[model samples]
Target: MPKVSSVIVPYAVYLRVYEPLAAFPEPERTHWARYARRPDLPSYQDELRRSLAGLLPTPPVAAPVQESGDAFVTEVDGVLCVCPWRTRLRGWLALAELDEELPRPVLEAALPEVVRLQAAQDHERWLESNPDARPWIRMAVWQVPLHWFVLVSDEERAYEKGTGEVAPVLRYRTPMVQARRRVARSLRTLKDSMDEGPLVEGLLDVGRWLEEFHPRSLVELDYGGLVHVLPAGDLEDDHSARDVAEGIEALRTGDGAAAGEAYARLVERWRSVRDRRSAN
Candidate 1:
């Protein structure tokens, strides 16, 4: 049995693309190359700790003044792959999404109206100048999005039953081409079986996001810190991608019972993790 610890970590999952160093233009490619060779590069956990610390100020620093210089770097077959920490832009996007979803009073309590407005205007201006920009990372709170599971498989899943300050981790990494192919096939199957709904829309959005990256880039699905909130059994039994694949196949085969069963298992498993948010 995997030993569960009381380590505290953020309850967020991230989908990130690590593009090859060659995919970048000169100066950036040069910069990342040097950064990757540095001996003191921050680990993923270290970066998360620093980011959380930044939110401890009086009003809370929602975003930084400039883009982050750090990146999550990995080596693939001797080639350097860098996923830049575009925290500033990601912050703006997060705020915008929150603003749309939350009530005014609730949103303002965390982010003052003035601060929120300023960030919105800044993002608008920034968008006008850099229309081609796309985020290197996307995050979800509480539970991983079902669409994300489409890009990975059970065999690719990696688990680390972390000890001490380290929390348990679950993630998957697949080449961009495979990820895109899976998304496309899944989208077609879902659309053909059902009407236009959230699943179809979500898959379309994911497909579009994947299209913005390099053909040879690597896609990752990190459970982030949510693993800490789940029970040991849940973590051990998690084969979300496999379940998702089963559901899709069942749908294609017109097997309603099997499809419903797979969908229920996926939803109920994540629902338990999400429901902890309101527990006293």
Candidate 2:
């Protein structure tokens, strides 16, 4: 099958994801090299080629990481690359899913030292390079070879420890949409939320476009609905799963605007709720 690689990183790396993502039209490739590492940038071009061989067999000239990161002056395949800002140290090790032939020790051994090095100091400062010469956001990236450098992050345990939250919103690529919808529908089968049902519906409405929208934000809103406002055992309680087979059907009718509106509404509602809480 496909040989998959993983990058487990600290929550800080997740925060940086949005910054780099905003710069590109499509974030197919990741990372723009910084000046400090310009001479070595060309080497990574091969890594990119190797990484994308299976996924995208036909390759073109190296594309920018996102478009506007503070990573100017880099080398891709020995060609010079320029990033707006320095990279960052973030990310932590977690689970990895890969092909049967993939090496385990290579992946594991790489992350610990990478995380440790990144933890020690902010080696490369990450930024979403803008005209103002200031970053919309900035963080450090922790590099560990053998890991395809998807998420540059730090440790998870320390993050939660400092934040003092039970389950932090994992700053990682997540496929939480259908899973959370299933959970919401299951709860609805028994007893649903009066106010929060709409939020769940909004998420359901997004459909495929949900990926275009940040799943991380959607996950955040859902967590708030379930944990903060929704009742006890609302999500975790055992019950007959609600057959959202009807709503699922509606989503397939080619309603991109409706789907977009629903997703946007959920985000707005979340913002409103979050704002109110902050004010209190």
Candidate 3:
């Protein structure tokens, strides 16, 4: 990979699942177990830098056609867990969406139509061969999606204040079983209490995503570099998961006013955060 800039953080939030080493098959399981003890494990910043570099070639490729060998590693109660960085697959998925959404001229400047078409074809071929493939990580560029909050709770939140060159960090981690249960509950609450709409649909999607992972995996919601732009106070007091939970409970009890207040706070907080994109 090319040398990256000194910038330590990227403005994106990630929802990742780290599966226990035992979840993988033979050789792969041994690979990650040994990989866990390596001194030169890649950092999230390094992963972001590597991805940025991939876009620099002419007719920029959004993702490589080959699968990535890297992963995000973590430990749970002294047990190793790994989240493979499916960069190529994610790139194909993203490129396909961009191609559909952006006008021909605008997209051509960054990614020519032919390149996009080829990536799309490659992705289709991948799906044909590996029908069960699923991404372990989901990212949102500026602000985290509201439904992601349902998988966690305020009690799980962790905040690490930045010092010197280090960037501030905010995240939440929970067991996959817990995340799946909460998503199921949230979806039931929304479906029973309200009309079918985006919120219910989104939670359903999250539920499906969680189902793809090992039941022993861990789910995480990392604020990524967004903490750098937010005020220290905001990072300190943010309880979006709690807010989401309260809103759902309010709906369950038919407290429309309370639910509206909680939902309003969440929208306003994220709106301010999303507005930072324009400021940049």
Candidate 3 ranges beyond 4 A from true positions = 1-5, 100-104
Q: Report clash pairs, candidate 1.
A: none
| Candidate 2 vs 3: which has more lDDT | 3
Ranking by TM-score: 3, 1, 2
lDDT of 2 by residue, 1-280 (tens): 1213232222122122122233434332344322244343322223223323322322211222233233323233344323232222112111112223237576444334444344333322332233223222222122111111111112211211112333332122222353345444533531332344543454443333233333332111112112333223322331111112322223455554554554454445445444544554
lDDT of 3 at 30: 86
- CA lDDT of every candidate: 0.85, 0.29, 0.86
For residues 183-260, write the lDDT of model 3, one tens digit per residue: 988888898898988888888888998898889999999998678789999888789999999999999999999999
Off by over 4 Å in 1: 1-8
Q: Cα deviation in Å at residue 153, candidate 2? A: 22
Worst 10 residues of 3 by lDDT: 1-10
Writing each residue's lDDT as its tens digit, candidate 1 over 62-87 gives 67778888899998788899999888
List the lowest-lDDT window of 10 residues for candidate 1: 1-10
